[model samples]
Target: MGRSIYCVVTAAGSGTRLGHNEPKALVNLAGKPILHHALCGLEPLGDLAGVAITAPANYLETFTQIAREAALSYPWTVLPGGSSRQKSVYEGLKGLLSFEPGNGQLPANDPTAIVLIHDAARALTPIAQFERVCQAVESGCPAVVPATELIDTVREVKGDTFTRQGLKITPAGSTPDRSRLRCVQTPQGFAGDIIFAAHDRAREESICEGEAVDDAVLVATLGHEQYFVPGSMRALKITYPLDLKLATWLAENPDRD
Candidate 1:
């Protein structure tokens, strides 16, 4: 029997970059909200043990309505989010703990239970990508994330100064080998106990808001190695206006993938 799997969708981001007054997850993509698309993508994983969505406190009702309409098979609820993404995720993890059977923490006898932390903005992440992350965790890898190779040249710059003479270029920067760099994506998978412990430690340390880039970074900070698997380009996060438009186009034309 497979261990139980739970998901926490971080949908509390303000869509300032997307130029929307509402939360990014509430923004519509091809008639349905982005959160709807995100939840639908998780359906292929079979019935989840629990699903928690962290959204703005003010819009909890709105998110609740959306989740109800999505009609997912598993149990789910909307949670009030915190000021920062890191805090929001922390809250989501806590919410999951409340739902887990027994002491609201990982059961020592069953360490195979897994948790997937995903970004709601990445509405189009393929079901296959979710499966890959889950498989890696079930295979005994404590931490796993999906990533794609960077095709662009990356440079490390020390400093830059501007001058009236057509902006002087500084030679203090050097190009790093792009071959070793991989652009990471979510849903990042982790053993239930591992993520719970990581979040608990971060809170106790009062880690600055947004200090860790992603859940994987927090896990890595605890000195755990993260395994990587290939991710789909279609899983791109919806941020800028152009990205929203492109995602809409992609949704309308499924044959393109």
Candidate 2:
């Protein structure tokens, strides 16, 4: 009676900061393209119930080529992304509608089907993380996001320079506790209806709910049940050109491989 799980891979960015003319997802992270590594995490998931790709409309061919090279023979849709990250996500959601409900689209029976949304930059999303999210989905939670603990010292900047701007101790006059707060990461999973509704609310209200570029934060504000599952530091997002160096190193390393 439960809805099936689907994964959405968002890769629709122009690598402006990477200083490359190519799409950010297509930038080679190692022997393969960055998005290739991203989808590798989902490779072992039995080819996924449905797969959605959001990339630059101009470079959909490039994404298709990468998908071919990756040997992904799953039922997938390539949707042209939007101008902003949110817009791109919406575009991916709309594209998923083309499929037959669980094949990737929204099912009438499983309105609350689990929809795992992940950024196509984090190539190393561990299988354990994906497994945990599926478990969370089974618990009937509205959303489940991977998050890591903050063991490092926390700081709150007050001014332009550390000299001009001394630490502001979170207005409590002492270092704020991070024992509870978590630094969330992607591969965030959610119920399809709940997630779509949350984003739809934001679109209707025209308000910024969360600062993070990820979408789960926007859903969390809706007062629905949201849980955090264990995450891996190995799941790194390829941002700069140098990040690919680290990705390659990890991929090539005998231990990491």
Candidate 3:
């Protein structure tokens, strides 16, 4: 049996990049919405205790209605998210822990075992990959994160600001190796109690971690070791307008058994 799993899907972004008034997750990805594909993929993971979805504050109810029509087959609640993506993640996590008293600061007796944090934009999350996150947590790591190996040559540019079109950077020597790097993805699972504590410490210590990729980065600073699960390209996130075409392509050619 799988642990008591709570999948938190973050869908708070306005579809500015996707070029729509609808939330990115609500945008059509075939016959269904991007969020529908995500929830479809997530349904196989144990008894989906609950799903905490974050959406734009104004459209929270709109997304909630969309979720209902998707027939997601799980208990879900829509949470109004924050200004930034990381802040949105924190808000979703808080909603998951709403089941706990005092807002996620309780002890082991009332533990929520494993929590899976995913993105609604990444509609292509595969069952096999999600299984990998659960399997990794079974070994007792305080946190478990999924990362696909990087295969590109990345560079670091120095100076106060970047002259490049969109890439941003910090001071010297802050860039990580492309070879050694793993492009992180979500539903990164964690020991619920520990991850909650980790986020708590992060809030206390004023650590920004710069929206590293997923929640696991913030958890890492809270003195927890993250175990990596091999990831797949099928789980790519649909963040840009071009990604919509890719999602349509994926939908047309699913490898579903």
Give the top-scoring candidate (TM-score).
1
The regions of model 2 sitting more than 4 angstroms off are 1-3, 102-109, 161-174, 209-212
Could you tell me which residue pairs clash in candidate 2?
Answer: none
| Per-residue lDDT of model 1, residues 132-200, tens digit only | 999999898989999999989988877675467956876667888999999999999998888877877
Model 2, position 34, has a per-residue lDDT of 81
Work out the TM-score per prediction.
Answer: 0.91, 0.85, 0.85
* Local error of candidate 3 at residue 60 (angstroms): 1.7
The candidate that wins on lDDT is 1
Each candidate: RMSD to true structure? Answer: 3.1, 3.8, 4.5
TM-score for predicted model 3 compared with the true structure: 0.85
Candidate 3 has an lDDT of 0.76
Which ten residues in a row are the worst by lDDT in model 2? Answer: 101-110
Alpha carbon lDDT of residue 9, candidate 2? 86
lDDT of 1 at 245: 93
The regions of model 3 sitting more than 4 angstroms off are 99-112, 160-177, 209-213
